[model samples]
Target: MTGQEENGATRKGPTRALVLHPDLKSERRRRAPELALAEAVSLAAALADLAVTGAEVVRLARPQPGMLFGAGKIEELKARIEADEVELVLIDGPVTPVQQRNLEREWKVKLLDRTGLILEIFADRAHTREGVLQVELAALSYQRTRLVRAWTHLERQRGGLGFVGGPGETQIEADRRAIDEEVVKIRRQLAKVVRTRELHRAARRKVPFPIVALVGYTNAGKSTLFNRMTGAEVLAKDMLFATLDPTMRGVLLPSGKKVILSDTVGFISDLPTQLVAAFRATLEEVLEADLILHVRDIAHPETEEQAADVREILESLGVEEEVPVFEVWNKIDLLTLEQRAALLVQDARTPGIHTVSALSGEGLEALLDAISTALDDRRTIETLTLGFEEGRARAWLHEQGVVKAERDGDEGHEMTVALTERQRAQLERLRQG
Candidate 1:
């Protein structure tokens, strides 16, 4: 996927994209190094649609107080951009407003950092009203911070007074003000959306279906696995961040009990703060899930690192509650027999782990049975006898779980029921009278 661009290389749209890898050495050395590499790869895949020719990695000696990268690197990058005729410069790191403006002036091309590119992808992928609002809010927050960058909005109105307005009230400032206003408006709109979603969740709460959320590193085939599990086409692809919106579908497990499975946006190491703020609504799906299926690509070299990154992100979001997590080592079809056995043995040592190839439908029935058993284990089974007059409890028991046996004796209709711990407790309280 790497190449060199030719001079006067015209394309139907933009062809050449200059990618710069800015390593936050201090951060990586302190927190995690493998995650940094995963971020770089995810950024490359995010910009895959831009016809990227090649990428350069700028390993910073030390963090510059003003700009992240040094002046010498910037000069060399400018020369490289001109020589390659790159139209779009994608920085695989965060760029400040002043640094972004300076880079554009020095390189003389369209400059975008990791946060900006993720927002752009979200803007394209968002479909629902809430998702669109969240994206807009995040975009405005990001743009408001980086107001010095040159774009179509800046060229319109420069500095002026009287007819135009004050120099402070120029186009950029005005746009910032408008974005601020829009942010507030979008927040209000999202509040409504949140209320609507809460209502839907409350309705689902009445049902006894256990919820499972599919989570993994970006481009780890989460949506593909989701499609295979629920038979729902929710934008499966080989690119990073392919699925932005959350999709939920019901899956009937082997136990004949219906369970809900949700496909969510993939996680990436060092995901932008603006994006985290914007996609909170979507991530809420994972938080509310009854079980989490942490799908991983066993064939990937950095699979363990990716798993650590996913765990870190989940812990940060406070979803590390005792909700059972099943480690599903996916993409086993691509692995060799030795690799598969090794992974299986390793997974066996870890509690509640399984191996499956979602694409080839191998070892899926076992996975389903595992899910069913996990769901059933979470419930407290109770043996109960119901009178004939309590038809409502009998119906509730049938709806919730299995009704083992019933006898219509001389006194009334006696029934034995198996239900969840909560349901059993509630029935016990009812039968006490």
Candidate 2:
């Protein structure tokens, strides 16, 4: 094992990993098998310090129930793993518990399916308390059914099973019950966290800034675009799931209006149901956003499929049908001159499409102008008389830089200020209070 220092102590390097994607030629696929295999390799590499030794797409007419792959195919992969000295096999699809156990016993190697690997990545990368709790909850939900993994202490029996049993409580049953209890505790704690988060959002509502949310498929350059727009040093990497927790920063639009830009966890095709449910509270930023920026990795070969997946997840989360969303075609710098021109033409024909390279800063001015226009459309200049007794409200308007002009009136101060519908509603709420 290779030793490296992290945080203060030495840590062992990750296990050597082999990745495989099952390519069923008889079945239809939205994305090419080669691209899917490459993505699988990337996902394997993304897991903390993992070294991907080899990766390939295995052609299959159909999967075997006993072992995902046939005996001949298993021997072929076993030979490859031995040749490469691979300790871990990461399958880019679901594996039933029996199939997983059989494969592990046959190859004498650890196996992880897509969902299990994702949970591992999330557990390693989560930073915030809520993020940590959510990942744990999702992981427990996943493990409740798969307690037969050899590493689990299933051989250790519990005391006394009143029901018909050869021995006492089996390890699997005990583990399942323990996981269920832990899930209940986590849900209770998470509910309290959610309530506190709602309180924070309610407090932010009084500040009168429109929330603009950034969302996209994994590694589509959303965080890079967020850094460019907000001038904040958010983690921006080519790796998938690099940004796990949500990040928000205030930015000034071209029209001199300040707005909050929120960067959220990237979406992936076939995202685990448990993760989607657990991260729903984190994704509420999208549901509550005044505008959503649907960033796209335009240069990717599977860009259309990825975009479809992103839209599917958004709809699954019950994003409002009427919420405004803008398509941001990113990574224009990776395209050839001819491809760039073709994209520009297509973007021109599209109603809400904006083409840009977040790295090179191309077409950002027009994008910023579009954002300004979208937000400005909601703002209105209105004349209002704030009584001297309402000095606090007058001060708030001034602090928000919404007061364009003001004058002393007979009873109070008369002012004309630009305000959004949300801002006006907040003002009314403040007065009512």
Candidate 3:
């Protein structure tokens, strides 16, 4: 059988899937197993063609090396799967290649671990060229690791390292070599796309508009808020990984200051390592942001945990410490009146936090006012000394319309300029360069 056939019997309609979250006793748990299972179900729902037939948290004292579950549990699950006619089993945790192969053979169903499931979702949601390439690259990297003897499709094609290929090459080795070659090819394509993105970013920088990035956990109403703030019709569905690619729109703030608003892919707990590396470029917008709005789904039960995960991802992405961040407590409409009132009271007291319901437009005015105030360009007049050789810095200051007066001196030029903090930083960079 081909790899796809071995994965699952060919079906004409939606694939019936069973979601399982392993509640291992020995593992240090970060999230409740029930909640994790619910999330897994939601993730399965994100795929249009997947029909989740059932979901549950399966408890385990320990994992079997080859099967990942004991004989009794395996047989029980197999019976249940057969009874339910489930074609796919989605495990909400890591599963090794050997265990996956064994489980598929024992259960007579295709198996997808957490990473594989996520890759499938990404593959389905990716739209842009770069997004598609990144997902393909991540999938290839993931597939290379799971190239067992059962994946017969890999043996049909062979083109890499012509001299090394002969009767001596094993199927698994050929498959891995092909995947590696594809990875290299995709990297080259990604580099070109990244260069184009950089050029666009450079052009945006010249526009003098600060970039305000909306970042949060998946399904946290970031896209809804982006649409609300910019009046742009971006996909704002309440789905995990709904917005896979970065989108930017120009918005005139309430204070008449124009800023570029960016909506980026949402973060998730325990994001696959392959995706984290592959989608790094997609999240680079967060790094260049002059201000970040950390939108939160306040209605979610695991709101605090989700916030921590977002912060962890942000820190890992190397977001600068100096960039200002505003915590946006979104989805207030989902809260009860008493809860909303109490949240508003707390939001009023907090300096950097705002509560709003992006869907209903409640508290959006105040949020906008706060965003305007935060991005206000309060200027300061200062005397700057630039050497004659530092013409680029002087030109930049003049180009920014910050230079008020200038005079030539023996060692350099003395200039009086009104500068915002951003301009000062830009000038400093120009000098350093």
Candidate 3: which stretches are off by over 4 Å?
1-11, 149-170, 377-381, 391-409, 413-433
Clashes of 3: 0
- TM per candidate comes to 0.80, 0.82, 0.89
Displacement of the residue 114 alpha carbon in candidate 1, Å: 1.3
Q: What residue pairs are clashing in model 3?
A: none
lDDT of 2 at 13: 60
Per-residue accuracy of model 2 over 248-342 as CA lDDT, tens digit each = 99999888978899999999988999999999988999987878999999999999999999999999998876567899999999999999999
Per-residue alpha-carbon lDDT of candidate 1 for residues 103-167, written as tens digits (9 for 90 to 100): 66677676777777777667667788888788777777777776664223223232110111112
- Local distance difference test values of all predictions, in order: 0.73, 0.83, 0.83
Which model, 1 or 3, shows the larger TM-score?
A: 3
lDDT score for residue 158 of model 3: 23
Worst 10 residues of 3 by lDDT: 158-167
